[model samples]
Target chain A: MDKMVYNFSAGPAMLPVEVMQQAQAEFRDFNGLGVSVMELSHRGADYMAVAAQAEQDLRDLLQVPDNYKVLFLQGGGRGQFAAVALNLMGKNAKADYIVTGQWSQSAVAEAEKVGQVRVLDGFETTGNGPRALADRWDLDPTAAYVHYCPNETVEGIEYHFVPDTGEVPLIADMSSTILSRPIDVSKFGLIYAGAQKNIGPSGLAVVIVREDLLQQACPHTPAIMDYAAMAKADSMLNTPPTYAWYLAGLVFKWLKREGGLEAMGERNKAKAELLYNYVDASDFYSNNVHPQARSWMNIPFQLKDDALNDAFLKEAKAEGLLALKGHRIVGGMRASLYNAMPIEGVQALVAFMDRFAKQHG
Target chain B: MDKMVYNFSAGPAMLPVEVMQQAQAEFRDFNGLGVSVMELSHRGADYMAVAAQAEQDLRDLLQVPDNYKVLFLQGGGRGQFAAVALNLMGKNAKADYIVTGQWSQSAVAEAEKVGQVRVLDGFETTGNGPRALADRWDLDPTAAYVHYCPNETVEGIEYHFVPDTGEVPLIADMSSTILSRPIDVSKFGLIYAGAQKNIGPSGLAVVIVREDLLQQACPHTPAIMDYAAMAKADSMLNTPPTYAWYLAGLVFKWLKREGGLEAMGERNKAKAELLYNYVDASDFYSNNVHPQARSWMNIPFQLKDDALNDAFLKEAKAEGLLALKGHRIVGGMRASLYNAMPIEGVQALVAFMDRFAKQHG
Candidate 1:
């Protein structure tokens, strides 16, 4: 096996080395079946077994309630922005959105095309930086749902507390933060996470929707986005991204072996602290987001001298710390420590940062 | 390397052994990037290079006209059924559909949910198996488009001739037949194929659409399915199935090295002939599809005594022939001789059929 690199891509981030090795071993033949898992018929017994286990394993890892149907769907996070509105925006024409950063803003845009959208308490740039979630907002009891992105990949901010949304169902686009830590699933009516981030691969989203929330999709909703239809078909309404789902299963099993979300949260917290503490102590480096709002999964920091950004990334790559460059929209360095990224990787990144700061300063 | 077994699954079917081997080798590190292609950023130069080459190679293989845009999309063929309607159904509210088998019927059903659909000379189920294409049909000159599935996967039928719908744009669901042969891009307004078959994996579809036909998507069309938007973004409007796209690029390169589509069509034709000749000559076996309409990719055959179906499948599996059992909806046996299936595999199947017939006949 090749020497592993510490990959910090925001999405399509690192998967556990064990998961990758297992996938490599099974790429040619899966479970004594002569065909690759990708070659098996989606309706065939073998593929269905893999699919069922993936959903079951995810349920076990998240401790997902029995009342919520877990759907392995295609079309990514952007697709779900429209899908969320189409499926849940019942007779009520308006949906409330809390815009903290780029992703939540995008969610509002897609929802606007499908139905009326109300951006409630949009993000205000504070002295430190733009906070991910507003301090407080007027609740709209009649709105279809309250939508927010728990973690913004670009903004590098996360909501540490669950918002108090009275009777309206809470819908979260947890694309970047899902599975990085444990959350109360019962509090939110629907939670969607793109698989590319912390889950498994690209091109699929795992939507966990409360059973009662399945009613009242828009008349023009695409069948692929119809929550009720998808649940009824058990996410086999169409050919799924079988390889991604299978790989996610491997990651789920790996998570269970590593002691599930509870253990993951502790390790992730330690990883975040190691980097944040190092940055906070150094006058040469600074993170823009407020400490309370900083995301544990994605930690974006900037060098005091902006001109050194390119040189910093190049040197980091040479050190086998890959993809530390922040999103193009937000210039600087962002290290995404997903569930698969080990604490050792974060320690290496902190060491690199310390060396780079001393050399440049 | 494990000894290869012949896989006869219809879709999510066989990929070239070379492709699988290369993917396995790169599962850990791609191009010495120290991260799997699945872990690379979609917008990164390395991944974009791979994505661009995939589109270029596919264009070269098919000789796709410059006027047509090749889009790498998510949500499979079932999604395209509605996307085709949502995007192309302009001022004219109706589209003509030729229902040949289970797939085409599905196309009509999904299209009906989005827009007006008129079944054009649908199959009457004559004494032979459901004929894929209607022998004669009235062309709806004023309709938005003429939709058909050139290959019906479940019924194991294919249309050897492109339909003559003068002036009106023609849309084909070539999910199972794409890349198996050369095609005239000028004849069709849009051509879509789910990647699970000849392309790469499930949950991704490649849509080749003429530049002029991109206008007038329905107001409710999901942004992911909007051709003009996807075309502008080069299919990176959202996160694509990056690993699948990379694997598909590898497949395209392999196809090019094997002398492109002309060579592939010849190999596929010869493989089909070998199996069809054996089935036609044997008294114990029978194929229902007409000679002209038989698919070069998938061949469905029945045993003289239906009771022997299970036994035949078991013996075939033990003999290293895997997934030969026919679709449950259309029972007996289906031997899908896709592009990856070697001529030797077909010969082995023929030999196995002979032995099974002798033992049971």
Candidate 2:
């Protein structure tokens, strides 16, 4: 009997309905403990178990190698932008950043504060359409790491293949695209993502780093931000965002029940294809990114006439489709189809778009 | 009805039952928006209203001066430890740290990473039975600032009056004692608290800094940690811990309903007096801290027989008085009576302690 709605906000995006239901069901009393999970001490057994199981579930889902240390930390992707530089560039003092879009460019700004940063263009665009990801980059072989963003939420660009960094450690900010399918944990020196998108909520960031890379953190690094220190403390170096971590655990369980990353990958591909295909077929709407570079997580499309932007959003809200307004930088519309966004939502979005186009044609 | 439980956690502690209930009731569909508050975009109108209202309510409760900028940020007290040093000691590169206990000592380590730190003994204990707070300290007037922890959670020491630092800016880590009572906000240059105790949850730290103190951040300071940058962006430089922030707003509203901090101060004083009075009267239990220095927030006591510690905790848990175990450094029992802890909880704890002492006497 509840009104049906599908949210399409880019980050701090939607999570599975089932996870939300279960969280509500036990919001006050967790595990019959007579307190909200958020109220429990992180050092206590009940909370430790919750923390450990969430890590285990994430490890199983990612099939992470034994040599990597998984840390759940506070501060979002921007925090890790500084943390990565502070943690890894201590000895070498330099790294290469492949600038893809807004997120990756922002990461460069943070890294520049810590050490030497070489910025390389991540993609080439013809006009304002058909942006092709640059497979080859002029990387510094002796750099501490090669950092890049796999999916750019603002520009709706993504890499279909991971870049090969050879001897240099490859680091990825997968904030928008992580857990969408699968990743090779051994391929990168580290992978960090803000948990707002596919994982759980904002305020928590998950970092998976090779144990060997953990030794060279800057002496001045805050113990909380020092990867080595946090790894040693098992990410309890400080009281973590406990509620967000709990919610992430619920999401991980939902992922497993829905057949893990493999099934999620298939569903996500189908959903992205549904929206992209409809956009390609329409004269009234179009997505600018190249087919190969178009993101499966965020699809940004523009209306033929920008004047109808408000009307489109208003009508969409009336029908219970939400957050379709595009980023100010790219003015039009964006429908973020993360792992939690079911195919039906995308179908509904496409149906709305068709009707909107017909009404304004 | 759910079982009654009073969680005595140090941080990531208890919140008002009404706030928790409201949060749970709206967990799935916040404000009938058909999406969890966590799922809403921080940049959106709905979440912005929530964020703004929280800050306004906090300002109203504290009577914060117009010159102070309040920031809700990620990472806990420890994160702010580094942030305070990085933000304040940029030009001067030195500060006096009055060491009170574990939390203050930890802050010194982080500050030492940034600049020269003078560690002044905060209190003197005579034979571990009575500790007296140092009324005056050998301070550096030319230093960037004077830093101290108002209430030490682990050692159960608290300052009844603020330390005078003349022209030097005074910063208080009020993580344990903030919002339990009324204080003159204008007396200190800056005040910060990890939200778990008196605010909301673990992920957020609330910082109230004088406008003049916001400048002079180290260039290398991560934007996420940079006070000026965070203030300029309204703590939205990145997606904030939206859910925790919302819950904190709910808590501020609850405080208003409960007659604000003045009423809270009276209630807390009564609660602390009841437990401390009972301990003072009992030969089987004793608290070593000087009455003048004893913490109203954290009260640590010792059993006459150390072997009965486990039994005490087990029995207390059964009676729903949870997390009474003391810190490892201070081996005894600690009961954190934060703002959310009602007088009834303290009464229950005292009655249980009396019965336990008689049984083991």
Candidate 3:
């Protein structure tokens, strides 16, 4: 038996062991300062360097362009839902939304209070497997921007391609998909991600916004949501989640240590395939996500017999697999194979799933 | 000499050594769970249990009543500046503010955007000091509530008196004062504190709102900021800052273990008095705040000879008294005395200050 259980629960999912250890070593007193990193002022030279380094590391990882402002703002992706509307929805504005699942739908609902938000497309399947049936969007010519959650935690849906927006701004909520793979930075006007999953922790949301879109924020937007204010203050308009920012920088460093996003992406693909391919070969266990649109980060599946679901879960737990229970919104089993979950973990999961399937069948 | 220097940055301030060590030990895999708390889903049983326990511990510490909802919201004290106005400034509403320093003045600015706001009084003596001028007040009888910042971080000001307003609700931005001492929770209708100083981290802001005030949020308020929605969700309607929440819970446990607010309050008072008294007795150093209204959390003092400021700072840094520089708005030195700062730190600072004063005087 392993020293600890294999965690399959999606974000605040897992981080590299080395990052945690370094953070711990610095916990009591940073660089002999005798105070934890949490004790430093957000605006102090010590903490500011941490923030700048984090932004730099992220830019290096994603190859984020110079024109875009990378902001480590507070509130989660939930905070961004309203902030997006309040910031982007301005005079004579109607934004387009792709309702992939719960998160995108929530975004649409929040956007409704600020402007005329029209949904163009979304995922229809319940979990992990997404059938993007966006009945060809009729985008408003004068719309402020287009919005979509690139990955939905609840339904486990993912976008395989960046939606083409022509000259219009393309905004993607890459809360889960960020750092899991690489994407073209020039294709989108803005990209925002909550840090809990792929970055470092919750509380911190990373927004990469093109300079041109900075002035379009709605007048009623709070100063924190005002990109101009955050940019001007260097994301220190208020005391930011300083500790989270530092931890994220550490995670970025870890990513760099592991050979950046491209290498991490390949590792993730391999892990996802190991589980999905195994699930497909056995009828005793079933995965419903369409093969073409399957998410490489989260894999949700179920036992053929619902009656054995409890036994499967219990045995999985006994074997040290944790948080495999699917989201209550969609009941079954979900194995979120984020970057931290090695291929070895996937192999272990695959082995266990097959064994359980044979016993149930 | 001590192993580490004393840190006195107000918010995003110092945390206990043990908590950081625990975080470090479990950074990569909490309890051998093979995942950092940062990556764990807020809804996962592990993180959920953490969220619940953190809240429970907080509630227990504050002795929060059943009717008072404790919410972990984002943005910083600055986010609350806007949110408080939008939530409490209901139909035909006007709010009154007592401007003490930078934070309160900012709150008034935010409140003005929502409705008619009155600056009831200012305790400032020509824009700098640590006391509220109690004599000047024009509090409006028709105002829905009276708002004040109990502790101003930059100016080192604190309110010694709670104003009587017949039936008007008192709202306080206790960002710096919270957990530093015990207070009567029933006296204020709403109290919000940022988690940087004296608490845990920078991302999570703890809001203790009375039930009656929860339902008064404006029509245009976002769901995440809507107090009623947040209270109903138990601070989890959206994905929370999971690792921060877990760390905060650990801090709460630490607070209880170190002995409740009373013990904490005595230690805090002693620490503040030690530094302040040393500064007062020195001809070379002086604190501008009114003696009675001085904040027990933040002590700002200036050297009599401005020419020696840089040398003093350099020498102090060499001696391991870090972050003693005052804010840019007010030049000199400011020492934030939070719960985690031991008396030994204060004693060390005073001893250094006295020796420096004797040599430099």
Most accurate candidate by TM-score: 2
Q: What tens digits encode model 3's per-residue C-alpha lDDT throughout B223-340?
A: 7778889889888888777767788888999999989898998998888888887887778999988776688988888999878888888888888887888887988988888888
Write candidate 1's Cα lDDT for B1-361 as tens digits.
2565888888898899999989988888888887899999998889999999999999999999999999999999988998999999897679999888899998888788777899975444345433344445777789999999888888888888888889999999999989999999899999999998899988789999999999889877888889999999999998999988988899999999989999999999999999999999989999988776788988999999999998998999888898888888889999998888889999899999999999999
**Which candidate model has the greater TM-score, 2 or 3?**
2
Can you write out model 1's per-residue Cα lDDT over A250-307, one digit (the tens) per residue? 9999999999889999999899888889989999999877777788988888999889
Q: Is candidate 1 or candidate 2 better by TM-score?
A: 2
- Evaluation by lDDT, superior candidate among 1 and 3: 1
lDDT of 3 by residue, A1-361 (tens): 2465577867667666677778877777677666777777777788778889999999999999889888999887878888888877767768998887788998888889888888876665544333345435666768888898887877666778787777778888988899987888879888888887788767889998889887877777777777878888898888888888898999999999999889998998889888878888888878776665678887888888778878988899888787788887778889888777777778888889888877778
- Candidate 2 chain B lowest-lDDT run of ten: B127-136
- TM-score, prediction 3: 0.95
Pairs with backbone N, CA or C atoms under 3 Å apart (clashes), candidate 1: none
Cα lDDT of model 2 by residue, B75-117, tens digit: 9999999999999995769999998789999999999999999
Model 3 chain B: lowest-lDDT 10 consecutive positions? B127-136
The DockQ figures for the candidates are 0.75, 0.83, 0.63
* Candidate 2 lDDT by residue in tens digits, A180-237: 9988889999999999999999999999999999999888898889999999999998
Sort by TM-score, top down from the best = 2, 1, 3
TM-scores for all predictions: 0.97, 0.98, 0.95
A12 Cα displacement, candidate 2 (Å): 0.8
How far residue B195's Cα lies from its native spot in candidate 2, in Å, is 0.4
- Docking class for model 1 is medium
Q: Lowest-lDDT window of 10 residues in candidate 3 chain A?
A: A126-135
